[model samples]
Target: MNAAAIDTSTPRLRDFPYRLRDNVRFGDLDPNQHVNNAVYATYFETGRVTLMKDPQYGLMLPGFAWIMVRLDMHFRAELRWPGQIELGLGVARFGRTSVTCDQVVFSEGRCIASAQAVMVLIDEETRKPAPLTAELISALQPWLRRGVKGTRPDLA
Candidate 1:
């Protein structure tokens, strides 16, 4: 909910199942010379796409496509033009028909922003929530924090 509340100390770090890099172009800055608030969402999307398509845990199977149902981003610090950021991602929750991820953007090792996204597994043909498969669930289990283990085990 609050971006500042994110524990930057440990950073919810996993191997960053995915990382996306984006350079701040002149166009990304506002009159105040800071990156526009809206652009951070694009960075977050890049990370989410990479996570879904990563070979380690592809959200879409043979006949399904996972679609984002909701997202919340909290920007703790401002990034200026010409800066580059690494978007870190990991599974925060995996459910029978949905998954949530904690995404953080970093520059020079400092967390500039963070986001949480919720996506629903959809049947390619019917476009409705579809149960995730066991194999997929197992693939994502390692990325969960130890304490959160079994919290969303229904996915398995």
Candidate 2:
């Protein structure tokens, strides 16, 4: 589903459980003198990757890989290159074989961009979607978006 289908109100960096900080380099600027639209995607990707790939998170399993199927980004304000950006992410929904994430970019306490991404767990051997395990679901519960219903009671 697209981000438009999700309700993320009053973008706050603290709302998301997963967060990281990075500088907005001069190279990220486009002719407009503001950060390029494309750069926001990379920033969002960084947040997701950092959370998923870390061994401590237990989001990864051998022989399985996560692949993004969709990403919808909303640009809210201008981002200048001379500052730093705080990225935030939280698991917003769960499917039998997929997970949806809500992500945001903030600078100086203001939301600069927001994104929702859907990722499928792929069984590397067959290159097909893999069902999420109970353990994986348990690990994800803590990363759920604040103030949003992210999972079904019956869902594993």
| Best candidate according to lDDT | 2
| TM-score top scorer | 2
Each prediction's RMSD over C-alphas, in Å, is 3.8, 2.7
* TM, every model: 0.80, 0.91
Off by over 4 Å in 1: 1-17, 55-57, 145-147, 151-156
Q: What does candidate 1 score on TM?
A: 0.80
lDDT of 1 at 65: 88
lDDT of 2 by residue, 65-139 (tens): 999999999999999979998999988888889999999999999999999999999999999999988888888
lDDT of 1 by residue, 100-123 (tens): 888888887778888888888889
Candidate 1 overall lDDT versus native: 0.76
